[model samples]
Target: MRARLRAPRGLVPSLPAFAWLCAFFLVPAGMVAVFSLGESAYFGTSPVDLSAPSLDRYGEAASETFRIVFVNTLQIAVVGTVLCVLLAVPMAYLITTRLTGFWKYAAIAAVVIPYWMPFLLRTYSWRILLGDHGPLAEGLGVTGGFGIVDTLSGAQLGVVYNYLPLAVLPIAVALDRLDPALRQAGRDLGASSWRVFWQVTLPAARPGIVGAALLVFIPLMGDYVTPAVLGGVQASVVGSLVSSSFLESQDWALGAAAAVLLILLVLAVLAAAALALALGRLVLRAVRPLDLAARLRPRTGTARPARVSGDAWGLLLRGYGVLMVLFLWAPILTILVYSFNDGRTLPVWGGASTRWYAAIPDNAVLMQSIGVSLRVAALSTLVAIVVGTLAGTALARAGRPIRWSLLGLLLVVFVTPEIVTSIGLLLMYVAAGPALSDGTLRLVIAHAVISTAIVAFVVQARLSSLDPRLSDAAADLGATPAGAFRRVILPLAAPAVLAAAVLASTASLDDVVASSMLGNVGTTTLPVYIYSTLRNGMRGDAAAASVLMMLGTALAVVVLAWVMQRRGQGKSFAAGLVGR
Candidate 1:
């Protein structure tokens, strides 16, 4: 008889996450694809009618209106991503190189705090700051203020501010991990600081830079909140268009088609970028020898290169860092100050009072929404942690083929626009009929789909740095695989697990896209509530609720930072947040 073949040790452990993604992610996405080829139902309970499938939906998606919005969305994403890279590189450099100990952690906290705060709250804060009669306009002494409130420029600014930290964290982690000796060696070779940075540091940090760009660009492409809140209808993008198609127009076929188009657009942009990069590399390679020859040519005079003063460079970077921190904190601080407004409207401040803050407990809907958000975030975080930890550990021990395959799937989850995910989940839940009728459950499941990928990346980053032999040693000591994981690997991964849990919870709390799509009347999350209120002219009480949410988010960031620090894995922990 042939010997029985056994599965790989890591394969079984990772099956839960794999299965979860297939059920919740792939199936829903497939359903969306199928729905895109169908027509809208005018009479049936279902939004989409699959009886007759055609590519007509795609044709409609390619109409003049969609083409304009698609172009605008791509422009915003490209420009915002470039700006994020420009700002994040120096900010990250300052945090990793200039700051030390307390200040270093303080700087990180500055970025993470605003990042962890509710996404709607942050964008809404900008509505107050850049509004007519706002502080900035008043300070500038403009007649009718800046008039940026309902413009593309306002949306662009908000997108950059909201996603800047996503860019910063990954770059900081990359710079922090760089070997100091490389810089020292460059100095020993008489290379100027500028030359050393350009030649060595920048190249070494390329992966982080690329990661940061994608981190900002992917989400920016699908962001509807910023454009909706700041730009209003005037600055509509593909994301808002898709959303309106589904929620307002009840045109499921058009929405599904738009979502598919958005994904395709993103992939096309990435491909174009890759091709451009490849062509640039070829051009650079062809010219490199000539450039090298020019450099190696004998000098006729004894003149040396003019060196920039290190003090000047340091002072400039420090100033830039200060400005960047102010940029990150400005909107949040604006929210806190406006939360004390005694007036009814959020933007207009009548007087400083704690009335809004005090009235939070009295708002029945707000209180209930907070409760729903907490419950959903808590339950989703729990599910993500369990599934993610297993998948993460498995990836650390799995074969290269298995690891790459899983990683690729997670990357898809990361890069696929959130609006696409939201629409897919919405379609999937609708298709499930009454079986998944519970709105809160739908919210939890959708949030968990995104969070699971985040946690897995964090845990995998932690485990990758550990000794694989530890598990082997446990096995050699007569321990079962389960016992070894419980006794050994679990303890070692506890910090990352906890850090990831906090991060995932904050993500779920801050989510606007998925929550808005998946949530209903009785199951609304706090972010969704705030979003609705903002749409109908935000009130003082809403600002108060935002302040409270920010405080909670800050506490969570503190805990996450402390946990990562305790294990001396602060750098990787930060990078893992963006799945680097």
Candidate 2:
């Protein structure tokens, strides 16, 4: 009787969103998959001609030039992911162990605030910093072949700096969730501090570490802006290669083939991870007998006093924490300082001035793009809030089949590289011709497609943590289902929903790859505008726009942090985005 009463609710509220995704997101993605098999067709042709498809495009993508790009993508992504993980693990440990109260939040803020700046601006700042006369090269006396700019090393550095939050937040979540009792148990068993960490804490944190690696690696493979501006023509990665094929070479078939290949590569990585997890489970099962026997046996060693070296190790970790914070923010701080430079060239201090800030309103193209981005972000966030909140609420009470299906859809959206999705959507839009090719509409749809999954994740986390009994109690009273949702669930989940909206708005504004591929003459977002400005040597103007965008982003993030803190979730919302 009790089990029957406890059955899940909210399934009915979810169907509208499920249908919306099927039409916009799923159908568009299916079109991409179908397009992958065919030759590039002339515009206004039938959408999918199943009559004759060929493998020639795939063969073309495997050519010698592309082979090198593929290798570089793998090398750079792996190295970048490794570097981010190694750097983040220690800093996460420091935050979880050493810091407390207000200082704890401050340390996390230091790490996350750099992300408030658009990614393109952040990567371009690296371009300024690595120039011949810049602080880094001049201070270190680097020159000739030893220079970082225009090299793969520079691209790798940019990737690590940009993606570090992906690693830190997840690992911080894992460490935050550690069972204190288990740590005490290890010490009570006479294990040293190092042994306790190795056996208890590190093992518990492995999931977050693996998640962090996947999050960093998947996007880094398709990174365009970093390699484009920082690595220049010399350093070719998969994203640059694919961009050239479509935008520069106009070989749609070859670009689609390459994108399809990249998607497969990401899928293969996920498959390997799944296989490894299964093998781990098997090994754990095989070792359970020995573990049980050992536990049953008595221990003879006396518990020693807690190790005195913990403070020393903590101090060392705290130093690394400070260094990591600086590494993440140095380029951004440089950009902020350079925005005020009166000189035409970057990194040269010509008396302090707000001339660039004053010039922003005069750049009509830049101002137009800002207007487009604001509208897109506003529309995207509104759509995401409605659809994602419904889906999130539905998933909370959904039975196993529905839950797994929605979860799989979310994973598909999450792990698919942005470039692959961008190209796919581009192909889909082109096939539909003039009637459906409205750039503003396409940009909004693309932003919503990407933003919905993230918003759903944030809302889902909050919904899962809600007390079902309150809604039930309201139902027992005079409240209708709609009324109960409004009075109980809605009020409880409002902060997370607000936070999700803020995040969605920021993501839409900051997007570059999709904006680059899908934006037409009428629709260029801030990131796309900044990319072009940098390419054309408009440093001061680009800096002006970036400063304005960062100010807006900073406002959004402050709201996000405040709401998340009010919910007592801390930075868990940031972790959830990647962990999902």
Per-residue lDDT for 233-295 in model 1, tens only? 777899988888889999989999999999999999899988987897788777765452243
lDDT of each residue in 319-385, candidate 2, tens digit only: 8988888888888888888888888765565768888888888989888999999999999889888
Candidate 2 lDDT for residue 234: 62
Per-prediction backbone clash count: 0, 0
Error of 1 at 223 (Å): 0.7
Q: Considering every candidate listed, which one attains the maximal lDDT?
A: 1
Off by over 4 Å in 2: 1-9, 42-51, 141-146, 284-308, 347-349, 559-580
What TM-score does each of the candidates earn? 0.94, 0.90
Q: Model 1 — which ten-residue stretch has the worst lDDT?
A: 290-299
Top model number, TM-score: 1
What's model 1's TM-score? Answer: 0.94
Off by over 4 Å in 1: 1-5, 282-303, 559-580
